[model samples]
Structure formats: C-alpha cells, structure tokens
Target: MPCRGAAACSALAPTLPSARTVAAGGQPMQLPADPIEAARTWARHDPDPETRAELEALIARGAREELAERMAGTLRFGTAGLRGVVGAGSNRMNRAVVIRASCGLADWLIERGLAQRGPLVIGRDARLSSEALCRDAIAVFAAKGLEVRHVPEPCPTPAVAFAARACGAVAAVVVTASHNPPEYNGYKVYGPDHVQIVPPVDAEIAARIAAAPFADEVPRVDDPLAHPRVRPLEGLRERYLAALDGCLAPRPERPGLRVVYTAMHGVGAAYALAALERAGLGAIEPVREQIEPDGRFPTVRFPNPEEPEALALAHALAERTGADLVIANDPDADRLAVSVPGRTGGFEPLTGNQIGALLGDHLLEHASCDRPFVVRSIVSSPLLDRVAAAHGARSVATLTGFKWIWHAALELEGRGEGTFVFGYEEAIGFSVWSQVRDKDGISAAAVLAQLAERERRAGGSLRARLERLYRAHGVWVSVQHSVWRPGLEGRREIEQAMAQLAERRPETLGGAAVERVIDYREGAQARPSYLGRAELVELQLGESGRALVRPSGTEPKLKIYVDLCAPADGEIARIEREQRERARAVALELARFVGLEG
Candidate 1:
C-alpha cells in the first residue's frame, strides 16, 4: 500500500530487505508465528533506519525471546509521559512511538478546544536521539493542524516549562530524559497551567494515543520547521533569565564568595551561569571537565547529581580552589545538589531534605506576604514543618512528585490560604519562585548562592547557618535507601514485597515506637482533596522521627526515606552522627522486611 501525506513518504517505507527473504546458515529462518508477524509490522512502520534494522536483525535470527520482550506491548504513557530505552518496537522509545504520542496529544488538544488557545511549545535536551524525536513530534503536531513553537536548541527542562507559561502555550512537550541514562529518552507533557499532566488528563491522552494511527499512516509535514504553522520560539533564554530575577532578594552585593559548579555533562551549565551572573556573583568557577553537554556522560558513571560519584569532579575543583560551596544540576537541570566544606577535611554533600529545609527557612525569613506558606512532599523531612511554624508560615504536605507539590501550592494560594514562597521534594527537586511552575535547578542554584553569600557577610558558613537552624528548630537528619529490581519479574517481586510489608507492619524501627501508620492507598476518603491515593505507606514515630516507603515513580526501585531528629541541647555533631546511623538502621530493617537488601 502506498503511504499518504508528505513528500518524505519514502522515509516511512521499509528501506531494508524483508526478514522472510533472509536465511541463516543457508536455511530458512524459523521464528515464532505471532512474534514474527508483529516484528515485521514494526519493521515496516519504523521510520528510523537504526530501529528498523534492529527489528530486522532480530527477525532474521529468529530471536523469539528478545523479540517478544521488545514487542510485548506499547510503552505505557503515564503521567510522566513515555520513557524507555531507545530502540525499535512499540515498547521502546523510537520514531514510531514518538509519532503516535504526538498525534494523540494533538488530537487531545483539538478535542478539548485548546488548540486555538496558544501555540504548543516543544523543546529537547542534548541526548543523541532527542533532536530526531523532537523533530518527529513537531512534524506530527504540525500535520495535525496545531501551531507549534519550537525551542530550536537543547535547553533545561525548567526553561521549557517557563516557555510554556511565557508564551501562554496551550501545552508543551520536552524530549529529554531528566537524569536518566544515556540509552534512555522521554517525552514530558505540560498542560496550560505549566505543570505536568496528572490523573484523568494523562489517562485521556493515553487513550487517544492508543487509538492513533500507525506510524507510517500518520500525516506528517516533510518540513515542519518551514511549515506556516510552525515558527522558531525566540527570546526564551532571555525571558527565562529575566524570570529568575525573583530568586535574588534585594541584598547588598557581597563579592568574593567562591562557588564551584558542575553540569554533569548535561545542558544546565549555560543557563545556570547566566542566572548566577545576573545575581551579581559572577566569579563562579565551573568544573571544566563536566561543564559541557555530552549525552554519553563520559565523566561520571551516571548523570544524576544525587549520586555521590557524579559530584566527584566538582568536589575536586572546590577543594583545589578553596571554594565555599559546590552546586550541581542533573542532565535536564530540573534538580539541584549542593555540597559544603566539611568540618574534617573534604566537602560534605547535603541531603535533598536538608537543602529543602534551608531554602524554606531562607525564603520564609525574607518573605513579604502577611500569610506565607511552604510546601514539601510527605516523604520530605518534618523539620520543614518546624521551620514553618517558627516563621509562622503554613507548611503543606502532598504526595511525591513535583506535579503534586506545585499543584498543592497553586491550590492553596488560589484559596486565600497564603502566598506560595517555596516548595521542594526529597529528590533534589525544588521550586524557588512562582514564575516557573516546576522544579528549577537554575533558580534554585541562584538562590542558594545568594544564601551562601548572605551567610558569608555575617561571618558564618553554610555549615554554621545550618547548625543555627538546627538549634532553633531541632537537629533534623534524613537518609534515603533504594533497592533496585529490574525487568518484569523484578517488578512483580517489588509488588510482592510491598504487599508483604503492608500485611505485616513493623512495630518498632531503630528503637523508635511506631505511633501511627498511614496507608495512603486505604485512606483516600479521609484524605484531603489535593492529596490523591497512591501506593505509599508512612509510619509516624512521634517526636523521634518517621519512615516512608514507596516505589520510585521514575525508576525500577523501592525507595525508603527515614527522618530522625533530636534536641540540640547536646553536641550537634554527635547528635547528627547518631541520628544518621539510626536512620540507616531503620532503612535497612525496612528493606529486609520488603525482601530486599539496603
């Protein structure tokens, strides 16, 4: 059948020989009946030569097991959108999958009468496959008769979110796997509110994608960039920089605060540096080795800043230059990591909870609203509640994920509750200003730098400031442990583990009595409207601490978070050390109960 639409129809046609025509060992290749037919269909529809040949090779060799794994089913488009290894088949992230997803999104927008509200903003990261996937998305949307605003270059995820709001976009899409491996890529969708799509919206769009036409049959503009409905999204960088101005509170310029930064070989260096310069601390040193964007991430084992080894280069640079602080951003610049000079010798990295607490306190102290509020994920440290109480600001807790955190903030502010000052999760994700409705590493880094400078002027270090906060509130410490299990069987094992833990709850952990247990899944009716039901369990341990266990939303792992605190009447250092050890013990116990190792 001749494919319709676009002069580049040949691109969608199979460019390789049929798998049935090739033989292995000079004999007819024998393959499974059902899987081979599906593979052949996938090969015919895949527009990229790499994925097409990949499927063809599998079919030629009669690789039934691998083929079955690849063609098991379509990739699930959940709230986070599509994410998987870059390869052939419907289960992976390829041109065929991206085309279908884009078509479905276009249809969903048109159906909701949102297509005419504003142009759809699209952006990408520096991954090897990001550009091609972004191109396919733009072409699909344009052919569907939606105006598209293309961000032209690799940028931070927060930049895309800001652009979505800046241009008043009906929706936005970004082709970047935030902090995932190089072999992986993703498609993230944002609604008109400039937040990630949640709940019924995600389900609705997924249904549309399921009903979308095959890759080759979907209409696409051969030259989407040149098409009348598509135009270059200009001034995004400048506008994003201007938007970051709110993060820098009016403070005297205290120069000479030596700060070291790293991008982890991602797309955050340029935007971070620009934001810092605009904040007046322009003499920041960049880790030359990992400053630029490289999809392969040659310098680190993983691109995530949460991984200690990922910040090894930045630490080395900070030590050599006698820097005061070190900051880093993940691949897509949606999360921030900070390290300070340790009391012993080398630099010590702060947990995401600690950073969140610090930023919350700082912003609340400087907040101007009569009624200010801060938000945190339920899994975050309870110390934020203490800080908010001290400052007389409301502290709200929601389910994990920035989508919920931002949504909670907006809901409260809209209800005359309070002005949203700051919000963060325990995964190094933060939102410092209201302009960018998502976790913004660029602005967070700027605000952290300002905080460090303010402390320096007062003859105090970040460590000293943290200690002061601990003394004022209580000494709070948090630790996270993850148990990773891969593949389908691993997923089942994880589910079974959760179920077992839920059935037999722990009475005491780390010698702290579990006063109350809150099963988020079971208490949907009693929970507030903003907090939805999820597979999460929380064990509140009175004043001693608390522990939360849930499966990671973005990765194949079970994550456990433990928070412990003590009065600062004794030595703060000794208290923190003891609490950290106790928290680790609690985490290990939880892991054992769940049939996994800590």
Candidate 2:
C-alpha cells in the first residue's frame, strides 16, 4: 500500500466499496498516492450516465484492480488543465472531474484574495457537452460567491484567453478540446494575466483543487449560478478584426480578389468571414457544408485546418470559384490553414510552417507602426528567423504550447519593448494582435484575404508570391509525424523505447548527422529548463535546423517535427527531392522504432 492523500483515497462508490480490489504485478494493488480519490470520485458523481454505468460495470466485474492504475490518483495537471476523452473513469473527463477542478481553482483564487472580485469569465467552444461543462463551472464559481460573466456565444479558445484580460477577471476557463476529436473536451485555465498558469502556480492551483471539497448542493446566491452576470462585448470582435486586418497590405480598392473561407464545422466561420468582409476584400465565399457549428463534426472526423481531408470541401469550393485563396479554421478557429492551387491544378494545403513564413514576411514588411517582434514555437520552422532578420525584427522560440507564446508576447509588451508583430505555434495557431492576447484566426483570415487581393492586383497569385518568398528567404521544409501511443501498454512500450534511445544517444537519424541530442529527463537539465519537457527528444540536424520528437501533451500520440533549410529558390526543388528521399529513409527508422502508422 502507498501512502496516499485523503482526497486521493476518498470513496468513489457509495454503493460498492469492494469494487476497488484489484492487482498490479500480481500483488494486491493499491491506488496511487498522487491522485488517490480519482477513480472513486468518478464512480460516484460523474455526470455522464453512460460513463458512470461503464465504471459501475467495470467495478462490479472485480476489475477494480485496473481502476487503481487509471485512478491511483487524480489526473496530473499541466499547463493545460484536465484534458482527456469524455468518460466515467478517473482517466476520463467527466462532471465530477470538472467539479473537483473548479473547486481547486476557486481555492487558488481565494488564496490570491481574488474570490470576492467580480465574476470570473468563462467561454466555451462548440464541442459536445461543452456548454454544460461551462455552465457547471459557472454554477460552482457562483456558489463560491465569485460572480461570473460568460461569453454567451461559442468562441475560439483564444477568445476566452483574451476575455481573461478583457474582463479583468481573476481566472478564465475555456471548455474546449482544442483540435482533439468530437469525443474529447477539455478545461483550460488562464491566470489573471491571461496566460495559462505556469510553474509553481499551476502546481499550486492543482494542489488547492485537490485539497478543496466539492459542494454537495449548488448554492443559491443573489445571482443564480445558472446565470452569472452576463455582459455584451461588442468591440472585442471589432478590435481583434482591426488588429489582424492591419497585418496585411491595406489595398482596399481591389474588389476583384476572390477568397473562400471555411470554419470546418467549428465556431470560427462567422467571425473569420466577417473580418474578411470588413477588410473590404469583397469576394468572400464560405464552404456551406462546414459553415454551421456542429460539435459532432459531421462533415469531418478530425477538426484540424492542417489535416488534408478536413479541407477537401474547402478545396473543392476553391476549384469551383477559382478563388484566389482558401482559408480554413479548426473547430475553435485558433489555427488557420490556407489552400492555394499548385501548378498541377491540385490545390496544395500549405504546411503550418509555410503559412508562418508567409505571414511573418507579410507582417514584417507591413506591420503596425508599433514595430512588433515575432514569436514562434521551438518545434516550428526556423525560417521565420530569416524573415525577421530581413525586416529588422527578432524571433523568440518558446515551448510547443500556445500558452508559452502568449506569455512570451505579454513579456515583451510588459518590458515596454517592441510590440508583438505575430505569434504562432506549429499546430496552426497564430496571434497577430498584441491586444487580443491569444491566437485569433479571424485576424489571420482578415489579413490573408487582403494579402490575396494585393497579390491578385499585382498580376501574381498567392502561390506565386509563396514561390517568390521561397526564392528570397530560403527553402524550408517542415514535417510533423505522429505515431500511436495509445492505452497503458502502448504508452509504456513507447517510453521504454525512449529510455533506451536516451541511454544510447543516437549519433544520427535517417543518415543525417546528429549534431546534438537534447535529452530532457537527465538531471543535467532541471526545474525552469525542464518545464518544457513534456516527453521530448530533439535531434539537431547539422545546419538544416532540427527535428523534435515528443509525445503530444494534449493527445495520445507521439509527434515528430522535422525542418530543413536551404537557399531560397532552387532550394525548394532541391529540398523537396532530398526531403522525400531522406524522409522516406529516416521516417522508416522512426516509424519502425517509434511505432508510427502515419
């Protein structure tokens, strides 16, 4: 038996105390001390009846032993709080899970002496069960005597991030799974500063949440928990649009630019097109099938702008309209991907790296008079550094999460330094506005619409412009590879392999010389430095930038990020040829060892 905290060991089942008897390693299994009550709590009050039934079934079948592994404790809280599949187990996301998390947040705020302040701001995406989960948060926060202001409409995750600053609330919670599937939803917490909680703060908040008690009954306050003080925010939409629109070459006269937009059945379609229209780029066409917000994601299985199939409909529309450009937003519209036709008449879905390079170039040449700096995720392409150099700006690389990028922006702004020209994560999220405070595709789309128009007027296509960019800067090729790391066994297997690789530090990958291997787990890198280690192993590919291999912090997958740099024009063809051959050779090794299917 392990020494466990009281919260971790709380009774998960009022009906069946015997349900937890199970074995790990053929010994009487004991739940972990870290999140002791995780399993039992779910068994008792998780809102999903199906999940609850599933847990009850699992427990009744004398399978409680497995429960120890799943719920030996609470889910570990990272920069992003409590993201997982919706289910009735300790490992899954459920109502009880949310309640516990909210309590933890409330306690943290009270400690900060922010509990008595005006309502906390809560926003949600159009994911299944998201609205209810957000409402549950409002209920709990209101019961705690903390007022609440809910963004009544579905919004991108960044909007909630911005609202944290806009409302000046103590905390902001966004109920979104980000780019995850329909079956998944998550809880994201933003500090009073509108940045995701980092360092001692996240841990401190989790500890408090783990220590706090759940309210048995919803408290009836002067303001109904169901309805926290709601306020109508008008200009936030306009301000974000204006800020994003400024990123383009304000060529308003060319009404000939035709642009196709798609939200991909997420919450961002309306605002994205609106921004484009406001930018005075008239020809705005929406992919009608994906226009409406549907949490089930009927049109596409994966709601990612970078996904090829996700934009198939959008591409078809582009072909139909001969549109100058096609832009697609993910479920929350935080990330944006553009599809421009190639020489072969097949529209090419530009990699996140390609878009970043173009957008960086566009902004560098014509950014706000404030003269902003560019921020990119460490895992993204380094080509932005070249563009920044040309524009006489700087590029800062942070951890993979957008939260890090957001904080980096705030950091620069706080110093009274250059304004944030642009910020992006490899996974398609971009923030063009220093004021909106988070990634806004609406802004990106507005700028992209105008950029497309300007390119048209100059007698060149956006694709042609990209080619010119490649010619000038350098040919940069970046690829993200994901391998399955599903369930307990698979996860363990992947880790064991990682451990072996770490111990034997490979000299090369796919014939490329490995200059350095950054192993995160060793004691050589500690605390503040190790904060970025969410299971990461980076391979520095000589002068061709590097490749980062890490498990997805948000999903059950291992990600391989590859980047190659060469002289601009001919380099694209050279890099493409080399990339295909080298990628094939090296990807095989990666796939074989890492167990990647795609």
lDDT of 2: 0.69
Q: On residues 180-250, what C-alpha lDDT tens digit does candidate 2 reach at each position?
A: 88988899887766667665678877776656443233232333434545444445566555544444445
CA RMSD of each candidate after superposition: 9.5, 9.4
Candidate 1 per-residue C-alpha lDDT over 480-555 given as tens digits, one digit per residue, 9 for 90 to 100? 9999987666778889988986788888888888999988878787876557788899998998889999887767
Model 1 clashing residue pairs (backbone): none
Score every model by TM-score. 0.92, 0.86
Candidate 1: count of backbone clashes, pairs at least 3 residues apart or interchain = 0
The best candidate by TM-score is: 1
